[model samples]
Target: MIKTFVPAPFTTHPALEGGGILHGFFGRQGGISKGIYDNLNCGVGSDDLQAHVLHNRQVLTQTLVGADRPLITPYQIHSPKCLVVTGPWPNGESEQCDALATTTPDIVLAVGSADCGPVLFADADNRVVGAAHSGWKGAIGGVLESTIAQMEALGAKRDRISAVLGPTISQKSYEVGAEFRETFLQHDARNSVYFAEGAKEGHFQFGLPSYIVDRLNACGLAKAEWTGQCTYLEETAFFSYRRTTHRQEPDYGRQLAAISIT
Candidate 1:
């Protein structure tokens, strides 16, 4: 039998509270991983031991749902692609997408992230839930909107969907170059409000969470909120890609944010 472990310092959102749904914004705590990966590292794509990664994921799913219910995650490639999940994929089979939505109860929709935002969505009225891995690329590419659309197709109303962003790199830790700023401005001049001068010249501090919340609200979600946690800034609570890159680490673990329709 696979050993069961529990996550520590898990987070939940008030907007998602009281629904017939169970969700968590899990941090990088509780598990058996070691070294740079530490414990509770859930990134299957990371360099952590494959067995350990599987065990960690198992712990997360079992804690939120049960040992019988499987947790499903996509082979995310920072795209806008979203899929409607009806049942568990065959072993070693995973979809190539960034977001997943389902009305099926007990099954968990999971998203993995380091510095990227993991947003959980639920329309309790219709028993539909979704999870998305939104980096700057996925955000700009419309992953959030795609997830909502998929949920709507699965009988969820845009006005009833509640979205909450989990731990992510806040603007203070997200610095970008001139080209990046130019791209957003090119997308929409209003996007400029999300950018501010960085400590270094020619660089801007990007507000990814704010931008994501704006997108969610504009997409007609009934409620939206950022947990106000920064992956890079909160070393104890999250794993940060930018921090790892800054420290020039060989690899970094990924945290999980998941939701299930009860």
Candidate 2:
């Protein structure tokens, strides 16, 4: 039987493009899933049917790499763990890491996210590429930094690495309690710049994308940019964990951001 495929289109950043590489920030479109997963949900950890998720992943691999190539993503646990992708793991959910880097060709390195910052990195001069999943915890714990280090080990240089942050929750939609603000402040008092007073007395809105971008810039990459797209706001196009929690839904789908050396 022929598997039907919808047009799983994706967005690209100039920083990661035109360097003998494949990169994309995919949304919730052009897949075979249903209900909350709608379409193109590439997360295997979600409660969505395993077959549907696998089908979506198969299509995702075909789109980013080739039908014969592989797409590998880690079993994310919101930590700073990063791995160098030397080969594809037998199970997509078996490797437990939040970020990945590789000098290998033909395999797509990807991370799943819904509002969390999905960061893609490439140093074409070195033929090294990386992908990272950075939520608030991962960001504070240094996942981005870890990813950069891993890529550099594979011969990527900081001055030549181009990083791009894909869709994430914006400040307006990311109100946090005073304790959350305190957490950032404790991590570094200067982090106050990423928070703004929320409507509530003890809450502040957090700027996730900007914070992630700032962290990348601090690493001295050649270029770092946020797509300026908000996953929480674009309901129809992207899946969002925070948005699902707001509506008291059981679970939400996860979009994929991936990169690879051609």
Candidate 3:
């Protein structure tokens, strides 16, 4: 079985209902990449060999979705920009966006992540789906809201949309400097609620998923939940940017979170 970490509030698609599947694969246990990427490194941008990355992606797609289903992913520029996809985009044509949405069936919507959050959204009623790559910058810039708007544009009702934030760096492992905190507060003083004092004097712990959840709720989505798996703290199961930096490793792996209607 593919033991994915799924959020409790988001309902799984019933086999009989055929609503499609929303799921994510944690990085670490499988694949052919070596060195800093170790095993199961799916990130195309990483220093890992393209052949190895392609093989890893192929393995994941076969094991998770199916043999022939292509996983759709964007270039992920850490912007709030979103793309409305109708079908499989041409191979190697990267979009300069952080989010993607579609109302079509069978094509998998995918996003890559290491320390950042991979957010997946679905509306079974309208057959609309979306995926987003949310780093601190993208999250603060309203990537979540942009995704919601795109889904609504595809005829998805806000009240029927269900979203889940996959594994990411939690507050305990995400220590940031004073300037980082200020950048958020500059946008809204209420952003302080997502920050807590860290061990160091000038640093603070940032709650990434909490901010994501708050944004989803603020957008009036009927259901939003986090898988609550902290990437930095769980080295055996996840790849973390902070962890890689701490070890002085050249590059790190990335996990894929995906959802599709079929």
| Candidate number with greatest lDDT | 2
TM-score per prediction, in order, is 0.96, 0.96, 0.91
How much lDDT does each candidate structure score? 0.90, 0.90, 0.81
Across residues 1-262, which tens digit of lDDT does each residue of candidate 1 receive? Answer: 2554454558998888766899999988877889999888999899999999888888887777666478889998999999999778877588999999998887888999999999999898888899999999999999999999899899999999999999999999899999999999999999999999999999999999999999998987899999999999999778889999999999999999988887
Estimate, for each residue in 122-158, the C-alpha lDDT of model 2 and write its tens digit.
9988899999999999999999999999998988899
Off by over 4 Å in 1: 1-7, 66-68
Off by over 4 Å in 2: 1-4, 90-93
Clashing pairs in 1: none
The 10-residue segment of model 3 with minimum total lDDT is 7-16
* Shift in Å, residue 161, candidate 2: 0.3
Task: State which candidate, 1 or 3, has the greater lDDT.
Answer: 1
